[model samples]
Target: MHKINVHLLGHMSQCETQESSHDSKSKDFRQSDSYSVNETNHTKAPISSTGGTNNKTVPQTSEQETEKRIIRRSPWIDTSSSESNSIHHVVPIKTSDTCPKENTEESIIADLPLPDLPPEPPTELSDSFKELPPINYGQSNSSLGGIGDCNAYNAINSKKRSLEDNETEIKVSRDTWNTKNMRSLEPPRSKKRIHLIAAVKAVKSIKPIRTTLRYDEAITYNKDIKEKEKYIEAYHKEVNQLLKMKTWDTDKYYDRKEIDPKRVINSMFIFNRKRDGTHKARFVARGDIQHPDTYDSGMQSNTVHHYALMTSLSLALDNNYYITQLDISSAYLYADIKEELYIRPPPHLGMNDKLIRLKKSLYGLKQSGANWYETIKSYLIKQCGMEEVRGWSCVFKNSQVTICLFVDDMVLFSKNLNSNKRIIDKLKMQYDTKIINLGESDEEIQYDILGLEIKYQRGKYMKLGMENSLTEKIPKLNVPLNPKGRKLSAPGQPGLYIDQQELELEEDDYKMKVHEMQKLIGLASYVGYKFRFDLLYYINTLAQHILFPSKQVLDMTYELIQFIWNTRDKQLIWHKSKPVKPTNKLVVISDASYGNQPYYKSQIGNIYLLNGKVIGGKSTKASLTCTSTTEAEIHAISESVPLLNNLSYLIQELDKKPITKGLLTDSKSTISIIISNNEEKFRNRFFGTKAMRLRDEVSGNHLHVCYIETKKNIADVMTKPLPIKTFKLLTNKWIH
Candidate 1:
């Protein structure tokens, strides 16, 4: 038995010496051999069972049994033998009896017979392997198992390769293998990690708060000392202005029983920074809390429509009319309020517990705008001898001049500067009016009204833009690194389409994100609706996702905002291409993109032009789904009729002549459906009613439906995402 144990030990020692010699030849050989062993754990290989060179497949031992065999070996034994052996006899050593006092690899190797040494190694092999660091087998318990455990073998090989110059070779192999089985090998990522990565990559910089501050926030905010003082001073100025205007009856204190506390409502100061670097504090009542029964709902004030403003500007530019802008100071204060209302003064005003009765229409009252509108309407029509246009109540005109009023801001168009001055003098006499722009001649007119910058070159062109609108709202963000580790220098340009997906966010976080997204979209919507028609479609598309915005939606919105900020200088210019006559026709270009929205709803786009100048347009989602492109086109035409009718009425009222209205569409089928008189031909279609109404308009000569090629339709930009070239062509070249 002793001789048999010695023989087995000698065999193991010989195998270990041969493996050590082979490993010393090349580091590449060690890596390849370790990989082969790992592969052979689950596959057939051409390794002999006796650890000799052989080309035969052997049945491998189970990994569990192999691990047990390795654990049972002596600590100093070489467990990295490439061959598997089964023990027939047991020779257990007791610590107190057969075991040596010192258990070490040198002692074990000395007990066994010495095997014949190999020939001297080559100089290249000696130099390459000599400097290779030895593996630290004592670092972990699992390392004792050595090559018996394929995982341990690979780990050790990885450690050794990391210390060597062949790291690139090992990395290449690992990357290749990982690429083939990446999905299986990758561990599941936590939701937090995913969100963190997305947030880090999405925004380049934080957007600064540019919104108005509430009264409390304004007073308490001390970040900027100058700004804080300005806010306080502005508040004082607002209080003084209200007192001078006698907005409320401060002389008499109203008892709580006299008026319902709810009806009395609350008031606060809204602080804002104006464009010219002046701080403005507006004292507004809490009109939102006012009961509906407190005021007449039917008396709601109407502001001038965008279409009317554009039409008037187009007319003024075409006819070389003198243009000027007027700003009414405390215009709402001049109007009386029929309803008895009360409001609390700001805390700092020292009117503790005393409620002031409202005598005039104060800003923030529900009916303030309507009351102011009526006052101005009465003064312009009865006092100034100007007649209100038939359709637009905010627009007043006479034989010599036309006036467009939006809230407190007003635009006057006159045949001469004297006529404009006459109206301005009358306005200044009745109410405090500031002339924002007084055009001295017909050659040039520049002014800003309702945030729109208007530049009119008489008989040449009228350009309308909302400059600094986006730049002032959106802030610079940090650009994220791409996969290649490079920063993107150019501004992001998003398409008109949004692909929404379910986002991974907690309910509260999601709601907060959604609120932020809505505010951003609101800013975009204002610019898109006012003059930047090129962004209308994109804004509409993004607005649809506000209910369930995700990281992708936020990122895309930032991109859209960035694009708008970069291209804010571009304006909507109306070139004078033809003479303006009383009989000139109102042209309408309509388009639709079918099944583009979620739930198969279509997109409707329309452009209203008068004498080759754009007056107004709309880009919105269809209310109902349309099954076909022709149906979508018909839907767009039907939807645009109301606006078109209003525009035509305003133009005819201005010109004092019956004007012809024409509808241009890219779809011949839609035109055919509108012009078709056969009732049975469209009986199967559900749009028969709309088609018949349109046909009546056509037959009655109120509208002329004509076919325009798709490429020539400027409204195409409003329906779908177009190539940048086509978008520029339609918006910059064709529209102008």
Candidate 2:
């Protein structure tokens, strides 16, 4: 047993460490000789016999038993030899580095290069040798590789040189016999015979079911559904009129290319961001007929051009009244087509399909705009009994309420005297319109009003927001890394470049960092909280660790989500209410991330409040160009005007009025721009024009834009990430 253990261990160690020995080889030789002696174990079943022992000892057998007894008593010694049966101990292999050549050969042969065996078969058959009946077979196991070898290996490794030489002789003889057999069995082909066979098969085939037409007789079909018939006839007559006039082509055809049918439709509805707080739908044609520079022809001349028009319409309506917006179901379908147009039907429709003669205005046609405008005008003026307002084609009125129209979009105000049902009934009778009632579903529709995201909120009809969306609907305005012309150097080394090109890559990186910081601080400020400067830096570091590559945007979004989750339990509330005074008015505090280039645009930070409720706020970059602090403030003021106006309308819409409105700018010159209104002009025409417009609008509504001392304004939180003391002060005023 000790020898066996040493042998197994030595086998494994020899393979691993290359140890060799002579005694191990001798032992292997002895084991192999034992395998040859066991032919019965390979070829036959075992033979069994029973015997009983004597009272004192085991019973002795006859000649066969005596020989077995001698074999058992002296297993290693040859029983045929006359030598005495002396037991010789089996010695263990030498544990030395240098092994004898004989031992090495025996050891290697014992560790045979055999392929791995499949799972073990039934083991009931004994491995020991015994006697059994013999049967003769041609494919003997010993003649082959060994017992249990797969036949597939013989086929793969066969080396029969004579088989390749007879290949051509076999093919010629086989082909000649096959040709003779085919000629004897088959008939010759003929054109007449083939045609006769095909005709018989065709006659025996099953026929498809025939379909009956629903409108074989137009007069009878019309009688069956009178209203539908009337509509069809009216449409046909309208189409005939359009056929007599002149129009452009509007039909689309695809040969074999893939197309997104919905994308083509949606693109038409999401063109520009407008100010009107209404359900708006915009469209732009393919303009494939024009050059790239001439694509302006695709613009719809009749759609509401700006948000100011929408706001003005809202302002003209009464306070006690509710404004309801109605969208025309297929608005273009109702417009009378006063032009002749032809459209080749779609590819799959049919080659011989007749073109659809235009009955109503459709997209992509030149005459469609004028026809739609004229149709809407006639309907509102003649059919609806609306009084057309002078100098405004879209604005219309009856004695009870005013209807403001921008092409197909109309806002109907229900005056204090008239009930809501009356206005709805009147509009329904004239045209097909869908009323978008607030709070219908949880899904939100986002649109930009003063560049703030307005979503439908409960208690009030809508709420204004300043948070960036997890996803943007329009492709993000590809914010350039650095747009200004300033030369930026790498980090750690001021004048060095990241690579040989000296791309100013580090400055681009810094610009992004500053932008991210600005956004974070903006959120804190907008919500009336002051983030710790170190906390901001720590957050930035955490951001770095999480986002070493292009994942920074995603990391920032996650951190923001975390921030929102952590702070969700509380909201900003004033600890104490100050008395109503001229100096204690709501103020907009301003700051900027300056001395940084090439993103040298000014940052606009603002917060507006009424009755201590922070009604509207924002922290963002100014879109307009500016060279100085005064210009920056003027730009910020222009950027903030629409928000302030929206807030005022919201207050009025909700019926809350405040005593005074003020704009807080640190720069006195910006205050001068506000105070002068139009009297003083600046070098940059952008500020002067926008400032005058803001002044005129504010003054017309009796609101004021004043510059307070910087310490008093709560909007300072927007400029940059602040230290603990200043952050706390700003947050304390806006948030309790």
Candidate 3:
């Protein structure tokens, strides 16, 4: 008998040891009990003996007994007879020989059939379970049962297929997730909305009149051979005109190398378009580059003051004087040049290689205006037998005609048409002059001069307006409404104000808007100074933000343009309803709005009225910050003294009698300060020098400071924004 020992193996241990023992003791265990254990659990099976063995019962050998004892000792195998009906019950087989030589362990094990086990219950998979990627189990090193190995290989292959299918599904889902993420990362496209208004169209319609053009630009701007020929002819005509006036010594042409380059002045062309569409060209010297030492102190020239013009207009309206406008042709060329200067010949004149020596004053010499002033002044005083006014060199008068000269533009006043004609004929004979208006009609005549349209009704009234100027500069608005179907309201008076935050804008956009605003404000300023007294305050306010502008400023400028366009037809009229007073009256209404500017500075507004007709005005921000309204008023009064003196002198000279000059204000405290004799009281205030000046003027009787109610003060329109009703009322009072 052989002793046998059974050892239990864990699940992970290989079955190679069991196979080796089975092969080595194949003969010894031929007649032993037949039972086996699988990798997962124990199973029982019954095996029959070989065919040659006898069916008779034989005595059990020690080996067989040992095997039986081992089987009984194994806890995994069920040996109870009462559990014979169980699926796992092992049935003992009867054999004749204890040790059979004919049969081997492999043959015995191969002959047994595996018991049927219930299929594993379908596994319940969790939601988090993921199928792993397929893994290749190439081969096994264990020498276990062939059937078990084959079955394990097949099961792995089935699981691998399942994992492969799950991996494919995960790849598809991942691609879908990535696609969704990509869409969210993309940017969306949107359309920008455009804002439009009538004022915008009006601004776009303004085309600045070209005053100076280069030779090439002139040719390019004309765009046609006839137009080009016209400019070319005008160029030749200007040169010829200069030659006839003996402006330059044409016979002594000097070589460029022979003259000092610094002494030689460069020349350019100045182009102008007449109302009749005639193009006029003038060859002007670049006198701005000339050194100041090249000329004497006579370079300064003075033109007629605006107050003089106003007085003349008032006198004409009162006395029914014949009025005429004359334009002096080539006035600057008629004078003689003092310094020895040379100029490069203009292009297309066939003298490019030569420089013309200037003999008489050319159009652009540093002293040309003074030379012309001297020549015209001498002509009027010496030749025309007219006496020059005492304080005004540009104004000349005689028993018959009085003339006012503003550069080349001249206005003539006379008691009859013959007297005006006599002066016009003398001017034409001495110098080439154009009679802009002859004053030949007894009813009414319209004259345009210095951007002002004057409509005079004999012995009735004189209406001054800028309808033509506005129309020529800014055309009418014929554009459609906004595309969004929103109708913009008509702009009324200028808004309350603009702040610093609203002026912050992008650099490029701010520059463009500022340029547009400059143009609009320039036109407004011209209108305001000449005729439209209502726009002075608005223009002054808009001028503060020209350098740093935003969308709000631009919109406000557009509104101002719209308002001016709507009131273009309005005018300032001087009526002759009553007989002229024995002596003229010069009245100035001055007001101030304290702490209204962005930096808390004050604004001052001044209106000069001669016999109740507007002559001149000023609206500007004060240079110094004022502490109180009285200080601001004192500053304004001081500033207006010069204007008042000028008006007073002009009126006295024109009427040949003493005139009264009065300054009206809405601040009673300011009037009291002006009339106060105790100057030390306000010496410590902010109005130091200004207060002193105001006291001196009031004490000397140079300015009469009076107080009026706020509602009655027309200068209120110049210092602050007013309601529509008040604005219109004041506007009508100042400008009829």
Give the whole-model CA lDDT for all candidates, comma-separated: 0.59, 0.35, 0.58
lDDT of 3 at 256: 94
Q: Which residues of candidate 1, in runs, are more than 4 Å off?
A: 1-210, 255-259, 476-501, 580-583, 683-685, 734-736
What's each prediction's clash count? Answer: 4, 6, 0
| Clash count (model 3, backbone only) | 0
Question: Would you list the rank order by lDDT, best first?
Answer: 1, 3, 2
Per-residue accuracy of model 3 over 140-233 as CA lDDT, tens digit each = 2111011012222223222122335323322223233235334333343332222121122123222342345677766656777887888887
Which candidate has the highest lDDT of all?
1
Report residue 285 deviation for candidate 1 (angstroms).
0.4
Return the top candidate by TM-score: 1
Better of 1 and 3 by TM-score: 1
lDDT of 1: 0.59
| Candidate with more favorable, higher TM-score: 2 or 3 | 3
Q: Give every collision pair in model 2.
A: 20-99, 21-99, 25-103, 245-340, 268-283, 275-307
Task: For each candidate in turn, give its C-alpha RMSD to the true structure in angstroms.
Answer: 29.2, 38.2, 45.2
Global CA lDDT of candidate 2, please? 0.35
lDDT of 2 by residue, 351-413 (tens): 433443335555554555656766777776676777655444565666555565655666565
Candidate 1, 481-577: lDDT as tens digits: 1323322211222121232222455444555565666677777777877887767877776665565455555665665665665567778877665
